[model samples]
Target: MRPYLFLFLLGIVLFFATCRKKDTTPTPSTPVVPGCTSLLAPANGGFVTTTSVTLSWNAVSTASSYDVYLGTTPSPTTLVGNAVSGTTHTVSIPATPNVTYYWYVVPRNTTGPASGCASGARSFTYIVISMPVSLGYHVVGYFPSYRSLADVPDIKFRMTNVVVYAFYQVNSAGSLLAPGSATAPLAAVATKARSNNAKILLGINDGSGDGKTNFKNMAASPQGRTNFIRDIMNVVRTNQLDGVDMDWEFPTTSDGTDVTFTSLMQELADSLHRDGRYYLSCAITAGKYAGGIRDAIRNELFPIVDFFNIMAYDDFSTTTPYRHHSDYALASLCLNYWINTRGMPAAKAVLGIPAYGRPSGITQSNTVLSYRNILSQGGNAQLDSAIVSAGTFTNYTIYYNGQYTVKRKAKLSKDIAAGVMFWEKWQDATDGQSLLKAACDTVGRSY
Candidate 1:
């Protein structure tokens, strides 16, 4: 009995000792971040022709509100707007024309004190143009099949007083057109524009590549170019188009090719300007050289062309970790690069954005995934990627690592460019709160 008592006592003593030891293992903690998903609007710097330019953004989920700042410098950032709620807010700029102003937004919540959300600082140039005026057109090709254009108020909103609104493009390359056709859609677009009391800028841009593209040779060869122009002219005559927008995917970098391309543009600009019946426009690259070509056009063809829209999106991959296309800063940099660095006029510089987004995790092996399919089960992990359209590729591969998927929201705000352009109107969100519409709203312009 004594031995059993001794053993029981020893066991009790050991348990007490174990319980008395202090635990040293660390507990998991939440990430110490000022805010999450605080964004800059206009994704690309947008056009402004007013004493005031609006700045807006999607609100941070954990943020109770936001603080807006503006200054010529990044540090000692001057406060402009404060305590803005909802997902978006607008800030006004009363600066003079062509002045670059920097801005940022901060998030505040109960979990954290009011802290700087300090987004990637963005900037834009301002000009004094007419009030509530912007220059652009919505060219929808994937419509009715993708979404209805009538449901898009952004298209009809600013378009009310504006001259041009929408153009239903008949793709000469893809399913948009049969072997040789443009008249049907051309007539349809014209009728709709007339009904809306607006002008339809005909889209003659062919996106088809080397093979299986009828317009490929047309853009590259002299005879083909001539014939293509004739076809476009015929459509203009038949539909009474207000103007023609030649969207040749790209031009030749070959020797003497530059001269030919310049000559072609000059002739088109000259002929169209002389007609006195219509306007001429071209969609050019968003790079530095675009400014050079635009200068040439202005010198030789500005008399005929109404404007040259710089297609600014599609710079980076949406699937990659780096933010692509509509990067707020990248857009600003491009605008500064072109206008300040390369020397292009702000009035003629219409910036382009994409209403569409590229799938990041979608690969060759497994391709189909909607916005729903890509979200994480817990919603804690977001497949972060930049939102922008690719320059000339159907799709790219994203490596499967922890179920990371990214999609682009190519909207614009901030201080940026003159106007905005989306690749196609049909790709706009169902609610009309799409990339292009967002840009329009930010700039206080409609549609």
Candidate 2:
């Protein structure tokens, strides 16, 4: 009985000893891969105007390095960076305009790359930096009273040789109408123009209601013309402006005002030139089809005015297949009509371009949109037309002079015209994609 007891006790002790040895043995653990990182900069679906873009991501604790993929497609296969130790990488993309690019970053460790990182990919649209165009050409920009004065940048003043404030109303009595609430705005712009050494002018157009009729009646009478010249001079003097820009939409032969239009301009020119400091310019029609109205800007008045802002964009030729209100062909024809056909001096012809775009279809709901708005709505800066989707149901195409067209026109103007003029300065994009900038660049003017 005693021997059996000893053997049982030994067996129990050995069983306990074996259990303790097994518990003391160590077991290898599985390694942890890096967690997914968040993307930063050039936010998803954003626009970048520069050639080089910096891509960055949030750092992960376990990440040993990062792998970068970038390409034109959604699932970017091109690996730009392999095992990059940093959290950011700058890649030089193509300088092409309006190109969409996609990119993603994968955090990696010795264990492996972070899973589900492909879903974190992002996209951006690239807009090429606008290049400089030409030198020794004038750039004229019109500023309407309705536009905010704050919209006009200091750089714009530097770009323009002449800036016209449009417009002060003209009453039937031939007296100048004040711009009312626009006084402060005008004063602000004037100060900016003076500081930038730019010539500023006050624009005159017919008043509201029977304004056209009043303008015609006033111009027909000698007394009315005399009053107009005197009142306009007084206003120009009060404003300390460089000169006046006359925007008589059209003086038709049917109304018998076409003849009076020349006489009025001639008289006004005489008064302005007598001062010796003030300059004179007139905004004339494109002369494509407005019969006597088009013919109204005769050769007799060409020598009187300092220059003619050939309103060359509103009317398109009948031969065009597309409804491009202002196209390269129209610009050429208008220049020809003014310089060659009308016998006006090439130096006196300033080609006019629109800073706004019209819809491709004549019946489109939105008649016009500013060039800035066009680009904001996904309009390509390189192309002349954009297919815009306004809402879920509204989709239309807008036609305007993109950077390419603007550069081309500016080059053409340098060849034959004095300079280029846009309708309103505020309508222009205030960036690298600005049509005004594109024109200035193409003409070799520094802004």
Question: By lDDT, who's the top model here?
Answer: 2
Q: What is the C-alpha lDDT of each candidate?
A: 0.49, 0.81
Tens digit of lDDT per residue, candidate 1, span 291-395? 333343334443335666667655544345434444445556666766676556555556555443334433322332222222211211233232222334333
lDDT of 2 at 306: 84
Query: How many clashes in each structure?
Result: 13, 9
| TM-score, prediction 2 | 0.66
How close to the true structure is residue 282 of candidate 1, measured as C-alpha lDDT? 72
List runs of model 1 lying over 4 Å from the truth: 1-184, 211-226, 288-304, 318-320, 360-416
C-alpha RMSD for every candidate: 29.3, 27.4
TM-score of each: 0.49, 0.66
> RMSD to the native, candidate 1?
29.3
TM-score of 1: 0.49
